[model samples]
Target: MEFVPEEGKHLHEDCSTLILPALSIGNVGQLVADLLISSMGSERVGYLDDPNVLPCVGNDAYGPFPQGDLALPLEAYDSPSNALTIIQQRSPVVKGMMIEFAKNMADFLAGSGKKHIVVLSSLDFGKWQKVDMSSGLQIYYLSSSNSNGTDENCEQLGWKKLQEYDPSQMHWKYLSDLAEGNVTVEDITSVEDELEEENYYASLPFAALFSFLKAKGLKVTCLLCYCSEGDNISDAFQLGDAVCKLLQLSHPTTGIEGGKWRVPLSWMSVYGPPPDVSIF
Candidate 1:
């Protein structure tokens, strides 16, 4: 991975937090990162160029005005006021290269001296039937073994750990059900075990990232929101608010209470009204 820093600007060596998002279900994590980049007035400090990442180009998502200027697929930002460095990943890693991408990211963080890494992500509710989706939304956390204060921080913020599933038990139940329907015991035993030993309840990038971080003993924390696949603006807003609370970026006196998370102007054209259509 190659980092191209902005001309005449460099990342703060002492930046404490590294905030990023894994491209997950509903795109909630990316949206939350967008809100942070806009709300915190973060600047593009650099761009990461890696062969493992898919190529993408688009207008800046947090621009003050629609200038039609193009942006890189992966850009990095810094919020000095918050003492945080943010990574805005607009695309997913190329297929089969997730492991390589995670390794490069781990190397970058290890060399950057950042103390904490926070990943905003989402998980599919359908895979885990136990997830309570009646409340419309819920945020959970999973921290690496080396997480210094992330566990305490989540507790102080009242966030819960994502429910874990026992793959062995689940697999056994499935095998038993198949056996009752004329399936032979030998056939069931012959089936390769598809269950993972540790299920973080996350999709590809987030799960791969967590594995890499844990193996390297890096202090990484993942904040996940349970969501369905649809117009998930509400999910993104809730996730943004959760991160805001965790980072103490909101003010009680600013009228930025519940359900009032800030939205960037770039989202106005997200669905596109077509080039011929203009709003007066």
Candidate 2:
């Protein structure tokens, strides 16, 4: 993997944080990265180009308005004022290359003098069944072995770590038995047991990143949400808000009635009004 800077540009800076997304359920991480880049008005800093990764090209998602103009697939951005840098992957990495990519990314970040790394991700909601939708959304953090300061800050802010579960444990067996019996929804105790089991069984991409960071003794933290597969725009918004609070990024209050979070201009046509169809 190679990072190619834009013409006449230098990436070295006193960057305090490096933010990126891990491709996971609901694409929540990618959406959060998009929100950060657009809301912060970050500029194109560079890009990661590698043959092992899938190639992608599309119009700038954060453009002033949605258009067909083109941009790189994996681009980097920086907000000097906030002392933050962002790496947004518009597409997923090719299969079998995640470990290599993660290692390269860790090396790049470690050499950048950045103090923190934040990865936004999501987990499968079906694995657990006790979602308290009325209590507002919940987000959890996982700090790297070297991130004591980050862990303390999260604790001070009252953020909880995600409850882990071992897939091979009795809890999972019980859940499986229940499922076989057509009992999709179990008792609260069973659900709690399922959700609270302590284990790390993240997807390959996330695991790769964590492994690389741990091997290099780098400080990193991950903010994650429980999500199901589908149109998860709401999940994305909630996670975005959590990240904003954690980083103190400028953000408005939640709720569409109150004021919705700013979505990228490129999403305007995501569902399509058809290029020929007009509301005018």
Best by TM-score: 1
Off by over 4 Å in 2: 66-69, 145-150, 165-200, 251-260, 274-280
RMSD of each: 8.4, 9.8
| Global fold similarity of model 1 (TM-score) | 0.78
Q: Per-prediction TM-score, please?
A: 0.78, 0.76
- Model 1 has a clash total of 0
**Residue lDDT tens for model 2, 106-214:** 7777777777788888888876556766667777777764322137777776677655533345444333333234343334344543444542344336655754655
Stretches off by above 4 angstroms in model 1 are: 133-136, 145-150, 165-203, 251-261, 274-280
Which digits, one per residue and each the tens of the lDDT, describe model 1 over residues 1-280?
A: 7888899888877568888899988888888888777777677888999898889898757666767756788888888777889888888898756656877887777777778788888887776656566765777887764233147778777777755522135443333233233343355444333433323342257755665555555677888887778777888878887877777775333224353545677788777665564653
Model 1: lowest-lDDT 10 consecutive positions: 172-181
Best model number under lDDT: 1
Q: Which ten residues in a row have the lowest lDDT in candidate 2?
A: 250-259
